[model samples]
Target: MIRHLVLFKLNEGVERDDPQVVAGAEAFRALGDRIPELRFWECAWNISDRPIAYDFAINSAVEDTAALQRYLEHPAHQAGVALWREFATWVMADYEF
Candidate 1:
């Protein structure tokens, strides 16, 4: 299996309640139902108050590298990414388990 993790930091001055952020987060929250390659999916806002904490996170898994690739290329995923690009920047890590 492969674990695909992502951490997102909202752009300076962007708030969680902004319409674009709300829709982008909703789009990701729905990906488990929309994508067939996902073996696991969880995403949410960060609860931490630490200065270094990211604003949001995605914890997901797939069968392997190929499955991960499909998830990345999926149209729904691409759409969500496009929306987020306007309001946030993120970092990611992927590894086998």
Candidate 2:
């Protein structure tokens, strides 16, 4: 399986605990149920970076890189990109074992 991980930093005016952040977290957590190619999805918030925890994160498990690519191009995900424009920086990494 391929593990697709992502993290985000919100725009300057956005609060870490804002409703948009909360909603995005929930939406990501629900992707597994909405997308057939998604084997698993996890969403997280309020991780303490000072204590070694990272920013908001998503860990998606897919059957292969092709499946992950499909997920990346999905319309639903595109919609999310629009809604999440307030995010400042987004980073992603993939690993397979």
Candidate 3:
């Protein structure tokens, strides 16, 4: 399986409570039920106030590279990405276990 992890940081001047940001976050949160490629899914906002901390995170598992690719290319995922692009940036790491 592949574990796909991502950390997201909101753009400067963006607030967590902002309507668009909330909608983007909800969009991501809803993906586990909407996408079958995901064997596992978890997303949450960061509670840390540390400067090095990201504002949000996604921790998910998929069957393999193909499944991962499908998840990446999925329309729901793309929509979530488009929404996030407007207010945040992200970094990710994928590894097999």
Candidate 4:
């Protein structure tokens, strides 16, 4: 399986409660049902307040690189990425396990 993980940090001056952030989060939350390649999904606001911590996280799994690619290319996922691009910066990692 491929494990895909991501961490997000809101742009400067962007509040966690901002409508854009909330909407972006909701969009991500809805992906599990819409994307068949997603075998596991867990996206959420980070509970940690540590200075080094990111504001949000996405932990998901897929069958393989092909499934991961399909998930990345899905229209819903693309929309969510665009929404997040407006208010946040993120980092991701994918590995086979």
lDDT of 3 by residue, 1-97 (tens): 9999999999999999999999999999999999999999999999999999999999999999999999999999999999999999999999999
Model 2's lDDT to the true fold?
Answer: 0.75
Q: Which digits, one per residue and each the tens of the lDDT, describe model 1 over residues 1-97?
A: 9999999999999999999999999999999999999999999999999999999999999999999999999999999999999999999999999
Give a tens-digit lDDT track for model 2, residues 1-86: 99988877776678766887666666666676877888888777745757544567778889998998899888777666666666
TM-score of each: 0.99, 0.80, 0.99, 0.98
Clashes of each: 0, 0, 0, 0
Alpha-carbon runs more than 4 Å astray in model 3 = none
Clashing pairs in 1: none
Q: Report the lDDT of model 4 for residue 77.
A: 98
Mark the 10 consecutive residues where model 3 has the least summed lDDT.
42-51
Off by over 4 Å in 1: none
Clash-forming residue pairs, model 3: none
